[model samples]
Target: MLLSKAGVTAMLGLATLYTLLPLTWLLLSSTKSREDLFGTNGFALGGETHLAANLSHLFAADGGVYVRWLINTVLYAGVGALLASVFGVAAGYAFDKLTFPGKERLFSLVLLGVMVPGTAMAIPLYLLAAKAGLVNTFWGVFIPGLVFPFGVYLARVFSASYVPDEVLEAARMDGASEFRTFCRIAFPMIAPGFVTIFLFQFTQIWNSFFLPLVMLSDQDLYPVNLGLYVWYSSALTQGHPEDYLLAVVGSLVAVAPLIAVFLMLQRFWKSGMTAGAVK
Candidate 1:
């Protein structure tokens, strides 16, 4: 038993190191000047740290275009995730709690959607967006992100697990309408699910790259991921160290929000997982 416990601890420590090693490199690299970035060992600290200058140059590049990309990313992730969570939760709640014509069939379709890869659907979505005059616009990226089939699936699971049908029935007996019952009783009961779906969708939309690449033509509409891609590509093509440095620093900055968000909502996420395990 002690040997088994030691083995598990060693494995977890190795996994943690593997996960954090790249981030550690990025953190150390971001603090180095351009010369030290290319000149020295990757894991070692720079002789001269220019983290502040690197940040200034990162933001000040090309008339503050990185700032625009950051804003666009926030909108694409934040607004898209919020809308997706609300819609997914509502749909899930309805799926679990209510009966209607062809309900199971409809949910089967949603499950099918979950099986379809987002990359595979990107071209089709672009075509649809083009037909709807949404291509090259914010809505092109924003609208597609709002349709998170996985979130819907999770919501249904959560609704079935977290929300009690007896409470819903009691609410109905007390003269509560369906919407009110859902709003007052069901929604609150499934709060952890809501947070889970929100975090999932938020992370998905934030890290999204391919869809925006296909839909958007204008650089101003680019998300941080795409923007960093542009910078990284430029660095390779033009042999520009400044652009390389910016990309590295930008990557570090981009990861911060995801970490912050997970840290903030980890409590609800853990509860959701616990409920699932119990169920």
Candidate 2:
């Protein structure tokens, strides 16, 4: 009943190509002018290249709004992911190692949180942020992303699998305080898990569309996705397709940071996943 190795290889090859197709289109589309983008075959090279000009207009548009959006995206994704990883790892460690009343029930609630659609919480989160006078502010978007239940769950999986009770007990047996043991011994052990969690949260917040759209009215507070949406919407309304072309180029530019992060940090994720799997 087992599949042949060639079948498996073919299946994997198809999956890889499927994943890369859209990205390939994005790269090609970004190099094209609006007229060419609309008229040309989707996968073909353009009649005339305009990547440099398009990027110039994308950056200079609306008084350099794209630059602001890029910076906002960095702050939102970077800081939110870091805090979410810290909280996730700490909560996960506690869940796996510590004895507490109603621990299972609490974790059930966390699982429920993980299952809840983020879109469903937008209004409620907006209301809460409004109540706290945080609406239209950086914190409104940043705060919601810091509590990632799925990240906590992932961390728990990593903790239970990667970290051993014996190592913790050995640290304790050496008269190491609980905090010191966790900081020195456990944190390094879970470093790969944290990187994985960080990338997850980073990608989530970076590509988030509706939550930031609901929470922040100011264009200055926008992540790249929302900012691009605004441009695309403006193009649709104004009957100018140039903005549409700009959005395509901007999308390509926005993804560069994520590609860089993966290129730099993928080693940690690969090693961590391998260790976790083998252990």
Looking at model 2, report the run of 10 residues with the lowest lDDT sum: 44-53
Please give, for residues 25-93, the per-residue lDDT of candidate 1 as tens digits.
999999899988998999988533488888888899999999999999999999899999999999999
Clashing pairs in 2: none
The runs of at least 3 residues in candidate 1 whose Cα sits more than 4 Å from the true structure, single-residue gaps closed, are 1-3, 47-49, 271-279
| lDDT assessment of candidate 1 | 0.92
What pairs collide in candidate 1? none
